[model samples]
Target: MKPPFPTLIATAAVLTVAVTVAALAQAPDPPQRSAGSPPPAHAFPAPTNLKVLPKNLTGEQVHEIMEKWKIALGTHCNTCHAEDKKNPAPDGRPQLNYADDTKAEKSTARLMYKMVEDINGNYVSMVENSGVPVTCGTCHRGHITPEPFVAPAGNYQNNGPPPAKDGEAPKLPR
Candidate 1:
C-alpha cells in the first residue's frame, strides 16, 4: 500500500523534524560525578604542622616515633637503614665517605633522614645523646608528604532560609 507522493514526502519531513527535536531535547550532558565515588571535601591548604616530641621519654616511646617516621618516609628507608654487608653502597643516596658532616645538605636524600647527634664518643647509641636531630616530621608536617584526601566534615548551610539572588521574582509559594 504505497502512499501518494506528496503524502509520503510530508510524512518523511515530519519524521525528520521529530528526530531532530528529540535529539536536541535528549542531548547528552557532561558528567557530574562518577559511580561509586565519595563526595568532595575541603583539604588542608598548607603542609602539615610538625611537632617535636619531648626527648625525655622512655626508650620504647622514642623508638616508636622513630619507627613511625621510618614508615612515613615510605620507600627511602632501604637506602639508609639497609644492612651493609660490605661497602655501604658508596655511590648511593648518601655517599658513605663524604667527610661525615655533609649528610644533610649534600644529597637529595634529606627527606628520608633524621638529624641525630652521636650519643657517645665511643659508640652510636640513641638515648645517650645530649641533643637529637630532626626526625621525619621535622620537614613533613604529619609524616606523610602531600597528605591524604580529607573529606569535608559537615554541611554548613541548614534549612533556615532560601538563597537570595539579584534580579529575581518572589514566588507566593514560599
Candidate 2:
C-alpha cells in the first residue's frame, strides 16, 4: 500500500531538516580569541610613543587606560587624539594619530595625569590607613570639565567646640 500524501510530505520535511542540521554540525566553528588576546575590533598594534605614561606598558595596557580616562571624562579618543587625515581607516574614516601631540588637549591630559600621580603618590599616600586613590572620575565625574562645587547655604551655629582628640575632653563654646 502507498503511503498517504501527508506522510510523504512529512518525511520529506524531516529529511530536509535532518540534512540541514547535519550540514550545520559539520561546519567549522567561528574563530575564538585566546585568553590573552584582545578582541579583533580593539586589536591595537604595539605602541611606539611613550611619554607621560609608563614606557614599558603594552599597547593593550595603554588602550585600557585610555578607555578608562575616556569614560571618566565623558569624552572620546578624538578629544585627545588628533585625526590622521593622511591615512584613512578601511571604512574611510580618518584614523586617529595617537602619538601626535599637536592637540592641546593631549598635552593637558598628560599634565593632568602627572598631577594625579603626584597627588596619589605624594599626598594621599602620606596619610596612614588611606586606601582611596584619586582617579580622573574623582573630580571629572563624567564631565569633560568638572562643574564647580557650590556649598550649601546655611548659617553656622556654635553648637559647641570641636570634638576632642584621642585623649582630650570636648570643649564647650566660649
Tens digit per residue, CA lDDT, model 2, 1-174: 885998999999999889767655664322323333334655667778878899987777788899999999999999999999999999997899998889999999999999999999999999999999999999999999998986454522334455689988876666
Backbone clashes under 3 angstroms, per model: 2, 0
Query: Least accurate stretch of 10 residues (summed lDDT) in model 2?
Result: 28-37
Query: How far does residue 78 in candidate 2 sit from its true spot (Å)?
Result: 0.4
TM-score of model 1 vs. true structure: 0.21
Per-residue lDDT of 1-174 in model 1, one digit per residue for the tens? 775998989999999888766655564321223333444352112212222335354444444554675565553433333344445454654323312333333243332332332223223444465354444554555544536645455532333334456777543333
lDDT of 1 at 161: 38
Model 2 segments more than 4 A misplaced: 1-39, 154-174
What are the root-mean-square deviations of the candidates from the true structure over C-alphas?
29.1, 11.7
Task: List clashing residue pairs in candidate 1.
Answer: 41-152, 115-133
